[model samples]
Target: MTHKILIADDEPNIVISLEYLLQREGYAVLVARDGQEALDTIAREQPALVLLDVMMPHKTGFEVCQAVRADEAL
Candidate 1:
């Protein structure tokens, strides 16, 4: 089974690099530029794993993780 992954990072380079790497490894990859976007993507897509950066605009990775942890859909 292919496991989907959500990537939340502020840097475009990091996002692209990881996107390429994960995709090449046969996993479905999703990218988010910030924490809020990450949270939104997670809510909409419900990926199996999330790679979140600690520092991001609007909300931090900690906040996103908390939200995901609290979300009943997860």
Candidate 2:
């Protein structure tokens, strides 16, 4: 099965590069502009891996990572 990867970052440049790299590696890509959106997407999409930015609006990457770890599905 193809793995799903989430790219969570407020910076367009970083998102673009990561999306491209992940896609090139044959993984499905999902994107979020902020930490809250990342968490929501992670819960909904259950991405196999999350590429998160440390500094973002609403919630930080650390917070998002914590939430993901706390979530049983992820």
Candidate 3:
């Protein structure tokens, strides 16, 4: 089975590098520009893993993680 990975960051450079690297490694990659986008993507895409940034627009990684942890459906 293919693993879908989500990269949540505000930095364009970091997102680019990580996306390229993960794609080369044969993982399906999805990107979110900020923490709010990350949460939206997570709910929609259901990625297998998430690489979240500690600092981002709309929300922080800690907040996003906490939201996920509190969700019963996830």
Specify the highest-lDDT model's number.
Answer: 3
RMSD of each: 1.0, 1.1, 0.6
Backbone clashes in model 1, listed as residue pairs: none
Which lDDT value does model 1 have at 24? Answer: 96
What's model 1's overall lDDT?
Answer: 0.93
lDDT score, candidate 3, position 40: 93
On residues 1-74, what C-alpha lDDT tens digit does candidate 2 reach at each position? 99999999999999999999889989999999999999999989988888889999999999998988897886
Backbone clashes in model 2:
0
Q: Which stretches of candidate 2 lie over 4 Å from their true place?
A: none
Candidate 3 yields a Cα-based lDDT of 0.95
lDDT of 1 at 39: 87
Q: Per the 3 Å backbone cut-off, how many clashing residue pairs does candidate 1 have?
A: 0
**Candidate 3 per-residue lDDT over residues 1-74, each given as its tens digit:** 88999999999999999999999999999999988999999999999999999999999999999999999775
Per-residue lDDT of candidate 1, residues 1-74 (tens digit): 89999999999999999999999999999989998899889988889999999999999999998998897886
Regions of model 3 farther than 4 Å from truth? none
Give lDDT: candidate 2, residue 71: 74
**How many backbone clashes does every candidate have?**
0, 0, 0
Against the true structure, whose TM-score is highest?
3
TM-score of each: 0.92, 0.91, 0.96
43 in model 1: Cα distance from truth in Å?
Answer: 0.7
